[model samples]
Target chain A: MQVTMCPERAIMEHVTSRWAVLVLQLLSNGEAWRFSELRRELEIVSEKMLTQTLRTLERDGFVHREVRPVIPPHVEYTLTPLGKGAANHLVALAQWIKANHPEVAQAQQHYDAS
Target chain B: MQVTMCPERAIMEHVTSRWAVLVLQLLSNGEAWRFSELRRELEIVSEKMLTQTLRTLERDGFVHREVRPVIPPHVEYTLTPLGKGAANHLVALAQWIKANHPEVAQAQQHYDAS
Candidate 1:
């Protein structure tokens, strides 16, 4: 399971990247978000990075971007059904880290002290 | 859930890095692996990157590196309990990606044709 030439690794990397993980989780929060909304929500991510991440996710078929013609134009990003499957697992991993931070911190202290 | 300055983000980043994910999946396959064995198994990962990934995982309490007092220095890497939790979720993510690649590919084709 180690060696991989599968394009899926690229998909995995795109989904699990720091910005991508946040993007997936944010979109999966049962709402569609415009570019500005996502930018505002993910406060720490640069606009360029967020756009790049979204493009990668879109290309991977995990994110659907909608564009509407308006006076100023309307655009929104949401997770595809397939993306929901990917997000479910990524969220589990993210929650696990959040829930177990104390144990990880304790281990860090122990390793440091030794 | 977007803006995060939490140290846990760093931990999550370390665990989800490309090499780290592969290493965790390999370890969670219920086997201990020496450095060389891992290098050989993960043929695409460079030695320095693999060592760095293992060190990060070790420092995060997700991996244990056992070094025996022997002539050639027998060292092995395995998942700690905490690491197992992290790996379980990652493996689920990996498996989902692997299982759903066909769906993803179909989506990709649809996107490409448009």
Candidate 2:
């Protein structure tokens, strides 16, 4: 694989990445999330991974990052219009996977047996 | 990340993978593809990678592989009904990425400049 992927593919990869999917799904709820709050919600995500995922999504225009000039200058993340558009599709895909889990599990069992 | 991924996340990863996305999009046209034909269509895909992707999809029940009994046996791969369901969503995502390429490009340029 080439070191630098095409922009479209790269963006697709970014949006569909494991962490990105979860992040997008959460942000789609229309509530702006503080960085710490998001980390709390996503229990398994490392702080470093979450930060990198947010930066990538922000660069891709799917996320809006705002640094609130509060006591400590907290950062809030929300889905941009473009991000919401992408998130809708990703959320649907995630739902589909959830709904079809049984079918896929059966398939895996059959595949492993043969 | 754990060596063994959750089933739903793993399935999501399999379907959205770069080569898998292209493969599903191509197969969604309702054509069964010979391995060589797919290799030809996806010019940059390595033979090993394509083979591995196909096996993964097949095991996941998203792809059906059939072997023709002849002088020289040829294996053909097609999307299963489940595969088609996933492919429809994937193809839509790919189209979305293509259509929104310019917006994303501008965002990247702006991001790079800052």
Candidate 3:
């Protein structure tokens, strides 16, 4: 079935996407980082996936990518005002996960053992 | 490289999953719903997807599925205490989406028209 084609839903899906969430969370640390820096920080993300995720977030107006016209390429990403708002919510979720990781861990063990 | 093998991350991924987000949001209304009732409420979700989402949530201790031994089959679902907590966070995000949908729409329009 064709779901309602709403931009709002599309944007949310993009931001809350698996890779998108990690990218946003990383940016919430209040430091602007270059593309490669972000890739290193995320560690497990593929170069292709990171590029694709950043492009989507930039398209949604939640990310700002700046390129410095220098000898070597230097592109940095920062959250836009709207991106900051989304990141605020995402950070809350992230902190919750960090604090309650043990509970979630126990639950998973129980599930696996059952 | 292998990412950290933590059940916490796994459970979070499950609950914050695409279909899982919608399912949790629906259950936040404080009413128990049958499996099919939820599928109808979500509208765009497939039976297989809904069942898979519910099973994951149940396995994580965030959802309770009770089966009634009737002539046919009757299975109902509700949030557990932990599930309620997760649902609370999800409802906040959902409400944010509902309220700011217009802004998101505007952003998307600009993105598309650009």
Evaluation by lDDT, superior candidate among 1 and 2: 2
Candidate 1 lDDT (Cα, 0 to 1)? 0.83
TM-score of chain A of each: 0.90, 0.90, 0.87
lDDT at B104, model 2: 92
**Which sections of candidate 2 miss by over 4 Å?**
A1-5, B1-5
Q: After aligning candidate 1 to the native by TM-score, how far in Å is the CA of B1 from where it should be?
A: 3.3
i-RMSD per candidate, Å: 2.1, 6.0, 5.3
The candidates' DockQ values read 0.62, 0.39, 0.36
**Per-residue C-alpha lDDT of model 3 across residues B1-114, encoded as one tens digit per residue:** 112225545665776788887788777777788988888877788889998999888877788888888979799899887787777776666666666667666766788897
Query: In model 1 chain A, which range of ten residues has the least summed lDDT?
Result: A1-10
Pairs in clash, predicted candidate 2? none
Which digits, one per residue and each the tens of the lDDT, describe model 1 over residues A1-114? 643337778778888898887888888786888999888877778889998999878877889998978878999899989888898887787788888988988888887888
Better of 2 and 3 by DockQ: 2
| Tens-digit lDDT string for candidate 3 (A60-100) | 77888889788897998998877877877766766666666
B-chain TM-score for every candidate: 0.91, 0.90, 0.84
Give TM per candidate: 0.93, 0.89, 0.87
What's the true lDDT of residue B76 in model 2? 93
Evaluate candidate 1 and give its CAPRI docking class based on DockQ.
medium
Residue A81 of model 3, lDDT score: 78
